[model samples]
Structures are given as C-alpha cells and as structure tokens.
Target chain A: MIPVTVLTGFLGSGKTTLLARLLKSPEFARTAVIINEFGAVGIDHDLVEAGEESFVQLETGCLCCTIRGDLEATMADLVARRADGVVPPFERIVIETSGLADPAPILNAIMSEGARGSGLALGGIVTTVDAVTGLATLAREAQSVRQAAVADRLILTKSDLAGEAADLRVRLAALNPRAPLSEALFGEIDAGVLLYTEYDRLDDFHTHTHHVHADDIQCIAIRRSEPMRALTLTLLLEALADHCGAGLLRLKGIINVAEYPHRPAIIHGVQHIFHAPAWLEGWSTADHDTRLVLIGRGLSEAWVLNLIAAIEAEIAEIAPQQAPAPL
Target chain B: MDEALLALITSSLALWERAGDVRREAGGAIALESEGHEVRITRAAPDVPFRWSITIDGRARVASSVPGLLRVLRAGLDPDFRPSRVRIAPIGITPS
Candidate 1:
C-alpha cells in the first residue's frame, strides 16, 4: 500500500513553512503533494517548490467538507493519470490541509474507500503547533486542540521565538498523550526522522524527557526490553480501544511481539478503530526497545503506568491450557 | 472463507450505511445477522495458533490467521479485492 501523510495545523502554525522545506528535500523527490488552501487566492501553493513530479493545489473551500467531492475526484484523477502513465510515478502522497480543516473527514474518505483507501495506506498524521502562542491558541481554539489530538507526531514550530517551550509541550501532551512531540528548528529536522514512517513510529509507552510546555501536563515514555506476549498487548489495546479510543486520537508504535519476534509489528490507531497491525521484516533502528508516547487530555499517567505493569505481570501467568487426548 | 461468504458479510454491513453504526460486543465479539446469513467474530485461545475465529451463519469457517480474517472481511465488504492492493493505491506503477 502507498503511504499518505496528512498534515494539519492551526492558522500560521508553520504548516506551509514546514511543507515548503520538506518538499525541497531529496527524500520527497518521488512524493506527490496535495496542498489545500481555504481561499481562492492560493498563495501558499506558490511558496512551495514543486519538482517535475505531481504537485496539486486544491482550492475548494474546506477539503473535508465543502470540497469533499472535488477532493475525491482529484484523487481519482491522480490515480487514473498515474495508472495511465499520464503523470510521473510518485511513490507516496502527502496532503497539506488548510489551517481551518478538520482531518477526520479527510481520513474517513481514505479508509472507507477500500480501493482508494487501501491503495494508499495512511502513513501518518502530522500536526504543527506554534510554540510561541500554542497554549493560548489550544485553549481558545477547539479545532487546534482537535488537530493536536489526532497527530501521530506533533511538530512544535517557532520554538526559538518562545521564552521556553517546556510549558507548551506539557499542554500539548495533556490534549493528546499518544503522539510523540518533536521540535522543528526553523521548520526543518532530519529527513530520515521527519519524512517517512508517519504514525507507525510513535512510541507512546515510553517516557522521554521533553521540553514540556507546562508543569501540569506530564509527558511520559515507556520502553520494554523484551517482546511482549501477544495476548497481553491485545487485551491492553482492546481495553484502550474500547474505553478511550476517541480520546486516544492517534496511537503509533512498533511492538516486539513474542508470537512474531523476528518480524516486528507496526500498529496505528485513530480514535477507537485500529488498522490490523502490519508485520515488518526487522526493526528499522538498531535499538529494539518498545517505545511509545501518549498525549491526551487529562489521561492519568500513574493509571496508565500501573496498567502496563499489571498487564506485564499477567502475561507471565497465562499458560496455555492442555487437554487429554480425545481418543 | 470464499468469495461468496465474504460477499454476504459485506452486503449486510453495507446495508447499514444510513445508520453509520458499528458494533463490537463484550469479550471481543462481533455479530452480524441479516435476512439469511449471520457472522460472528471471536478471539481464539492462545494455543490455537490463530488469533481470531469467525463463524458464518452458526457454521464454523476456516481462516488461517488474523490477516486471513481481515482478508475475509475485506472480501465481504469491499467490491474490489486484490490481496496486495486496496481501494486507493495508484493502479499503475509509473512515476508521475
């Protein structure tokens, strides 16, 4: 499946700036980028440099709502053209949604349309938060909160202008504990880390030191040394998927499952629904630690920590039941 | 398990498009019953080798594994079912 990354953020959150930088990278040489701007005058599209490959500017109101039909038609056309060899063969697609857009509908379009959705797997969702005024914006703009909530990787932009980003990081974490927060220096980061592997790389279970935006919100990371038993992880995921799936917004991680140790399982979930975990040949990085980051609204850090501990303990006691021969 | 069985489940789920309701019950169970067919999804015991088991119309069906179960579900719901590609991947491979 082709991976498609969705980029969402509030107004002036540096989404366009980030996209501009990313499009220039050699990593995006084979990428097809779709930029959607709200107004008729699409200036943001002008800012980004497009290679000989496909670069579409969608100026159809709100992409998820008013222009859904148009967006679908555009995607269909892109697919048809690509299939017919009418366009360059792009390996991946990235959508830069307008600042005011809601990403849920956009995702629904890709997932429900099996041919279209299946053909292009959701690589991940990336949302940008303006470091200087992010806390106030999130507090006042519910969409901003929702945008951050659904991100697999939250890129904190304009950190240099802010006094200190530690407080802003905390607030973002509280809104969406499952997303791994990374700072973007002048809208740029290592292409290897920022470009590919969308939501699949977010490690919500591990606690790493981050420049927390505020002290009230705690960002924690958990890492497991050994492959976790499949049943234990499944149960834990199911419970989370059942009770607080919506709150989860986004969850991404590479898990070392005992059932399939040689091949790591990559998991991605949005809200309550989760895609069936995909198997990868081996760990992408030399470090095999099971790392996960959780960003959510008022999610109990201690409760989550205890839950993981309890599940780990239960895994040891779950022996397979044996039965006598049925001769 | 086969194309016919898969079509049956897809039709039933597609029927509820207007309602937009998806149901998953306790103990990781899912049931779908319609005019003539029924489907139930249950988790298998760890020793079974398969992670999931699905029964169609009260009759046990065979799926080699969880990915296989997803394949079955996709066949039932999706009109187009090429195992490697889903509904949205670019049909042709040429770079544009």
Candidate 2:
C-alpha cells in the first residue's frame, strides 16, 4: 500500500510554506501532493512549486465540509492515473488541507478508502503550528485544537519569530502528549519524521511520554509483554470505538497477536475510523511486547487496562472449554 | 432562498489566490472582478439541480454545486488552471 501523509494546521500557520520546502527534498522526489484550499479559488497551488514526477493538485472547497467527498474521489483518480502511467509513479502521497479545516473527516476519507485496496495506507499526520499565535488559535478554535491533537508529528513553524515557546510546548503536550513535538526552523523540516514507516522504528515510541494534561486531552500508553489473542484485540478495539467515538483523536500500535505471533499487526485509528489491521511480515526486535499509544480527550487508561484484562480472562476461559484433547 | 449560496461565493473568493475582491451590488447581486475578468453570480430557479447561474465573459453557465461553480470560474479566469477528474472508490474498506 502506498503511504499517504496528511499535512494540516490553522490558517497562516505555515503549512504551505513547509510543504513548498518539503517538495524540494531529494527524499520526497517521488511524492505526489494534493493541496486543498478553503475557498472558491486556490492560492496555495501558486505558492507550492511542482517538482519532477511530482505535481500538486488543488481541491477547491473546505476539506472538512462540502468538499470532503471530493477528497475521496480525488484519491481514486490519483491512483488510477498513476496505474495507467498518466502521472509519475509515486511511492507515497501527501495531502495538505486548508488551515481553517477540521482534519478528522479528511482522515476518515483516506483510511476508509485505503481499506478498500486502493493501495493507500495512512502514512502519518504532520500538523504545522505557527509558534507566534498557535496558543491563541488553539484557545479560540476547536478545529485548531483537533488538528494539533491528531498529528503524529507536530511542526511548530516560524519559531524564529517567537521567543523560547516554552508555554506553547506545555500546551501542545497537554493537548497531544503522544505526538512528538518539534520546531521547524523557517519551514525547514526533516522529511523522515513525517514519512510513514512500518512501526519498527524504536525512535518514534521512545521520543516522548505523557508529560502534561489540559483541555481533558491525555495520551495513554498500554504495553503487555504476553502475546495477546487476535480475537481479544479486535474485541478491545470494538469496545474502544463503540464507547470512545470522537474523543479518541488517534490510536496507533504495534501488537504481537498470539495467533499471528510470527508477524506483527500495525493498528491505526482516528476517532471512529480505523484502518484494517496491517499485518507486517516480521517483528522489529527481540522484545515482542504489545505497545499501544492512544491520544484522546476524556479517555481512561485504567478503563482500558480493566477492559483488556476482562477480555483476556474471558477468552482464556472459553478456549479451554472448547479445546480438543491431544491425540 | 439564496443567501447561503451568496455567502459561499464571497467566502470562496476570499480564499482563492488569484481572486481580488468580491463586490455586492444592488438587489443582492454579487460580482467578482479579478485579473481583468468579471463574474456575476445569482441563484437560479429551484426546479433545476444547478442552483446558480454564473455569467462571465458575456456567456452564462449553470452550476449544480459550489465546487462545480468554482470549476466554471476557474475555466473562465485562470488560463493555466486545468481541471482534474475525481471518482469514488469501488468498494468500502473495513477494519479487520
């Protein structure tokens, strides 16, 4: 599946500027960019330079609202064009949404379509925040808060203009403690941080831990060394989606399922939307523990722990009763 | 009946890069003149799916949606703009 990274932020937050610089990277040479502007005309298309085998298509409308359907349609079109050799063969895709938009709907469109075998996987979400006024925007707009909350990597832009930004860091951690926060010096960002990987990279999980809490948003990490039954994992996620809904901003994990202990399952979810379990061919390390990082508002780590234990016990009870005698 | 449509048109203009300014004229009519081209938009009768009639370069066209209308305007005013076709996926993806 081709990985598609979502780049989002608030208006004047320097998303386009970062994208313009990102396109120039030798690392992103084969990446196709889809630029969505929140108005009748597209001004961002003019700002971003199209590189070889790389072109930016503009979606005209709010990404979170009237044109969300268009976003899905656009994805299918892009894949078809790539298959037919109408466009350059790109290994990945990057969607840059309008600054004033909510990112949840856009994320849902991609994950749902990707599950249909369009050969697209949600690479990761990279949200840009203008260090100068990011705190104000987050305080004023729910969309801004959600945008920052869902990112896998949050890029704080124009940090040179702002001093220290210690308060902004604290607020960002409170809103999304799971996502590793970094500053982009004048739109210059490291491409590797935004690209989607197989969850093998230890660096991603090791980068941060839950440090601060605000706005009822908190990051919860669950790790169990015992290999879990796949059925129990599904049951747990179903319960999560059934109960959590939109408060669950994002869920990412690399799990060791007992039924498929040889390979690992990469789990990703945004609110009620979730990608089908992406089965990896192999494990990343000798330590095969299940590690899950969830960023959510009003979610309880204690509840999740109790729920997992209950399901594991119930499954263990039933498997023994239904077991076949050794021949 | 068409106040929302007018607001969308105005907001779209403000967001688009090439667009200059949107002007509201007498009788609730709206006009946008940018890059030496003028576009006048008014809501069409309710019977048609195309909700609005847009007149540009002395030629009139009907648009069924805001995105459709944006296409019409881009075709008229932006010489470098090219329209891309979009289609929905064939099957629904499920969480396995």
Candidate 3:
C-alpha cells in the first residue's frame, strides 16, 4: 500500500516550504507529490521538481467544493500512470492542500469506494500553523480551526520569528489535544517524525508500536498475536463505533485471524464510520502479530484493554455454538 | 409561513439557538428558490445521487449531501464564504 500523507494549512502557513525540504530528504526520495494551489496561476507547481507531469495543479476556483470528483479522477489517473511506468517510480505520495481548502473531503475521496482498489491509503494529516499569527487566524477563520482540529500532527511554522512559541502551542493544544505539535525553523524539520511512518514493520511474537504523545490525549497501540475470531473483532468495532464515534480520530491495524491465516485483514476507521475491512494477499511483512493504533481525545488505555478482553471472551463463548452441525 | 415552513422555522430557530446563533426567520427560503430568494429542501428519490433540492430564484440546484446543501446555503447567506481555488505554493518559513 502506498502511504498518502496530506499536508494542509491556512493561507501562508508555510506548507510548501516544508514540503520542499521534506522532498530533499532521502526518506522522501521516491515520493510523488500533488500540490493544490488557490489560483489560476500555478507558482507552487513550478517550484517543486519531482518528475515531469508529476506536479498536478487544481485550478478550479474552489477545490473543496467543486473539485472532489476531479481530485478522485486525478488520483486514479496517477495510479494508472504509475502502474504503466509512465511516471517516475514512487514509494509514497504526498498531497498539499491549498491554504483555504478543507482537508476532510479530500480524505473522504481517498477512502471512498472507487479509490480504495487503486492501492492508495491515507497515511496521516499534517497541518501547518503560522507561529506568529496562527492563534489569531484560527480564531477568525473557521476553516483554519477545523484544519487544526483534525490534524494528526501540527507543524508550527515560523517559530524562529516569534518572541515565544508557547502561546501558539497552548492554543493548538486546546483545539486538538491529540495531535503532536512540532516546531519548524525555516521550513526545516526532522522528516522521520513529521512524516507518517510511525509503525511500518511488525513482529508477531512481540509488539511493535509508536506512542503518539498528545497534550491531554494519548494514542494507544494494542498488539496481540493470538488468532482473533472474526466475530470478536466485529463486536469490538461495533462497540467502539457506537460509544466513542466523535472522539475517535482514526484507527489503523493489520489483524491476524483464526479463520483466515493466509490473508491478514487491514482495518481502518474514522469516527463512527468504519471502512470495509480489506484482506491483503499476503502480510505486509513476516511478523504475524496484530497491531492496532487508536488516536482519540482523552482515551483511556485501561478501558480499551478491558474492552478487548471482554470482547474476546464473548467470542470464545459464542464460538462453540457457532461450530457447524455434524456433516 | 406554511405549516411545514413554520415548523421548519421553529426547529431551525431552536437549532440555531442551541448552536448559539442569535436569530432565524421563516420569511423565505435561504437558498435556491424559483420565485424569489427562497429555496425548498425536501427528500429526493432514494435512487438519486442528491437528496435535497435548493431552488434559487426559481432555479433548482440539487445537492448530494447535507454538507453540500450547507455549502450552497452558506454561499447564499454569507457573501464572504467564497470557495477559492487551490494553488501550489512551497511550504515556507514564516515569522513565528
């Protein structure tokens, strides 16, 4: 699966500078970038050099409103072109949204029906906030507030110019307590932490996880290798969806199941809506363990652990009855 | 206001009040309308992609989802809610 990272910010939050720096890193060497600018004239497209025709500009007046279909088609075309070797090889994809654009629709398009089979999956949402004026802009612009609210990572650009970054950090924490806030100097940041590669590899016997540190929120990773019954996973997901839909930001994992050993299931969820579980032809890697990362507001790790145990126990009880009648 | 229109006004008033808005009225439709600036929003056939119709000065525009409907309504209600095109710009170094 190609991990697609979404970069967004309010007008002039320094998203492009950050992208330019990130692309130079060896980690992003094989990455394909799609930048959306908010004008008929496309200067951002000219600034970045990735591959010929790889830089796409969405000149539609309002991308968030009028260009969702266009965005979907563009992604499809990119996938098709890549498969046909028409474009340079890329291991990852990054999408930079215009300053005034809403990131949610773009996210929905990626997770929607026709796009899933194209081998593109959402990596994470990174929002850039101008350190000097971020707080004021967020106060005035509802779109900016929502952008900060839904971010997986918050990048504070122009931190060096500020007398103090503390006030802006405090404001961001209040808006999105679950996202990690990082300071950027001259658009330069450590790509490893900024990019979404938190948990790339897996080990079945042992748990491999990343603990996302948030202000009052915590992202908990639950790793289990024991083969889980299908019904157990269903029950757990149902409970989560029903009880904590709004607070739940995102969930991503690969599950090892008793019924399907050869094919591990890829599961992801945003709020109450859970995407249809996808079964991979083979494990992304040899480690057969189940890794579940849950990002939410004020999540209680103990509660989640108990909930999983309870669901598994219920499944254990139901499995005996679910056994097939004698042939 | 018609009965349904009055009720819609009442409910919207309640909703607006609950959401901390100051005032709402049932004088006319706020979005797409054929005769005037009033628009009618009702459920569309299940098979249709859009579930709502917004008529602006007798011109009806269908919307697929609530968000889409709201977008139209907002554009009509607030002139500043312009949907600007997206452009490509380098993520820059800004003053903190």
Candidate 4:
C-alpha cells in the first residue's frame, strides 16, 4: 500500500509554509501532494513549487466535509495516472487539508475501502500549530483541538516570531502527550522528521500517564509486560469501536503478540476506522512490552486496562479447553 | 470471574458515557438497564458451543466471545453504532 501523510492545522497555522519547505528537500523528491483548499480559487498550489506532474489541487470545498468523495476520486485518479505513466512514480502522497477542516473525515477518506483498494495506506498525521496564536486557537476552536489531538507529529511553526513558547508547549502536552513537538522557524526543519512514519521507534510512548484536558479530550497509555493473545487484541479493538465510537479518536500501538514472540504487530486507528495489524520482522529493541497510546474524549484508562485483563483471562480459560489432545 | 465480568460491563457503560445500571440477577445472570432498554446476560449451557446468551429488549442472541457480546449490546443500545472493520494491507510502501 502507498503511504499517505496528512498535513492539517487551523487557519494561518503555516501548513503551506511547511509543505513548501518539505517540497524543496530531496526527501520529498518522489512525493505527490494533494493540496485541499476551502475557497473557490486555489492559491496554495501557486505558493508550493512541487513537480506539476505529481501535484493536485482540490478547490471544490472542504476536503473533510463537502468534497470527501472528490478526495477519494482524486486519489484513485492519481493512482491510475501513475500506473499509466501519465505522472511521475511518486513513492508517497501527502494530503494538505484545508486549515478549517476537521481531519477525521479526510483521514477516513484515505483509509476508506476505495482508497485501500487503490493501494493507499495512511502514513501519519502532521499537524502544524502556529506558536503565535496556537494557544488561543486551541482554546476556542474545536477543529484545532482535534487536529492537534490526532496528530502523529505536531510542528510548532513561526516560533521565532512568537518568543517564549513554553505556555503553548505545556498546553499542547496536556492536549496530546504522545505526539512529539518540533519547533520550525521560517519553516526550516529537518525534513526527515516529518517523513518518519514507522511506529517501531515510538520513544514518546514512555509517557504512560492519563492526561485529561478541559475539552473532554484525553490521552491514555496502556502498558503490559506480558504478551497478549492475538485474539484478545482483536476483541479489544472490536469492543472499543463498538462502545467508544467517535470518542476514541486515535489509537496506535506496538503489540507483543503471544503467538508471534519475535515479530510484533503495529496497529493504528482513527476514530472508528482501524488499519489491520502490520507485523514487523522482529522487535526493534529489547523492550518487547506492549505499549498502546489512545487519544480521545472521555476515555477511561482503568476501564481499558480492566477490559484487556478480562479478555485475557477469558482467553486463558478457553485456550486450555480448546487445546488439541495428545495422540 | 463473575466479578471481573460485571466490572467490565459497568466500565463499558461508563466508557460509552451513558447513564446505566448493571447488577447481578437472581440466577447468576447480569442485568443492564439504560435509556428504556433492558438487557440480560447469562452464561450458555455447558453443552452449547456459544459462551454467553444475551437477551436485549426481549430479543435473544448467543455470543461466543466477549467481543460478540459487546457488539450485540452496542447494536441494541446505540441505534447508530457501526462496528469498525479492520483491513489488512501490506506493511509498507514498495518502491517502484
């Protein structure tokens, strides 16, 4: 599956500035960009200097709300064009959502059945939070909060202009404790940081505390030393989706499956949509413990922990009964 | 075992942010009432392959696992609930 990264933030949050910098870097040489603008006339494309053959501008409406179908269709068209050699063979795709858009629906589009069938996989979410007005925006805008909450990486843009970002950093940490924050001055930052999508090296997973924000958004991390049964993991995800619904925003983890000791499974989900577990060749480090980070609204850390324990206990009871007898 | 199961059910209700009450009934069955809906959960007979029998609002269904039970409960309680389907894809991008 071709990996697709989503670039999202609130209005004037420096999404285009970051994209322009990324496009100039050699790391994004073989990348295709889909820039979604909310208004009638699209100008973000003009500001970006990517190869025209691989660049797409969606000016219909907000990619999250009105033009979701268009987004899917555009992706399919890009894949078809690439296969037909109509455009450059881009290794990955980056979707820059409108500043005002809620990224959940756009993410759903990329992970939708049609997009998956077209060989598209979610790479990660990169949300740009303007340091000057980020705190105020996050305070008043629900969309901004959701963008920051679901981001895999949060970029603090224009930090040079807005001195003393300590307060904003604290606020962002409270809202999303797992996503690593990077400061970008004049949109100049290491391009490799934004392109790294592998979940194997989740160093930030160490923050295992439950952080609850005023908007009912919270981040809960679950860690277990014992390996979990694959069935238990499946059932746990199913139960979470069935009950939590949209309240469960983003869940990503590296699970140590009992059946596969050496090869850990990488799981990711946005809202109700979850990608199937991806098995790694081997554990990245000696730490093979299961670490899961859930960012959402009104999530209970104890409940999730208890739920996993209950499922594991049930599995243990049934495994013995279902074991094959010795011949 | 029953206590853990009851705790899970209660926590499940709380996770959904719904006002509900879960209590053990007379015959070792669990009863859940929320938003004018009634649910009864009982262990299946030893001879049956299913693990639990769940009856919601006079409708009966058998769940072979805890996940199945949650699905049934969500369908009965939340009218707009849709189970998120997981799809397996290739782990990473294959360069052309």
Best by DockQ: 4
lDDT of 2 by residue, A1-327 (tens): 888889999999998999899889888888889998988988999999978979888887887887556777888889999999999998888999999888888887877744346878777888898899999988998889988988888889999999788899989977877677888997788877777553634224653334345886777877778777666676667656644556788888887776667777777777756666777777756767788887777676655665576555545544666432211
**Model 3 vs. true fold: TM:** 0.59
Q: For model 1, how does the per-residue alpha-carbon lDDT over A223-278 read when each residue is reduced to its tens digit?
A: 67766666656655654453344455455567777656666666555555555566
Lowest lDDT 10-mer window, candidate 4 chain A? A318-327
Per-residue lDDT tens digits of candidate 4, residues B1-76? 5777888889888877678999998889999999899999999998999999999999999998877777778778
lDDT tens per residue, model 3, B1-96: 123323332333232222212222364333232212454555456788765566544566786433344445445544455432321121121111
Q: How much is B55 displaced in model 4, in angstroms? A: 6.1
lDDT of 2: 0.74
List residue ranges in candidate 3 displaced over 4 A: A24-27, A39-43, A46-54, A59-67, A138-142, A170-180, A192-198, A201-227, A239-248, A254-265, A278-314, A321-327, B1-96
Interface root-mean-square deviation, each candidate = 15.6, 17.9, 19.1, 5.5
Clashes of 3: 28
On the 0 to 100 scale, the lDDT of residue B85 in model 2 is: 38
For every prediction, compared with the true complex, DockQ reads 0.03, 0.01, 0.02, 0.31
Evaluation by lDDT, superior candidate among 1 and 4: 4
C-alpha root-mean-square deviation, each candidate: 12.2, 19.3, 14.4, 4.4
**True lDDT of residue A272, candidate 1:** 57
Residue A88 in candidate 3, Cα distance off native in Å: 3.0
DockQ of 1: 0.03
Q: Give the TM-score, chain B only, in order for the candidates.
A: 0.47, 0.71, 0.45, 0.85
Give the candidate number with the greatest lDDT: 4
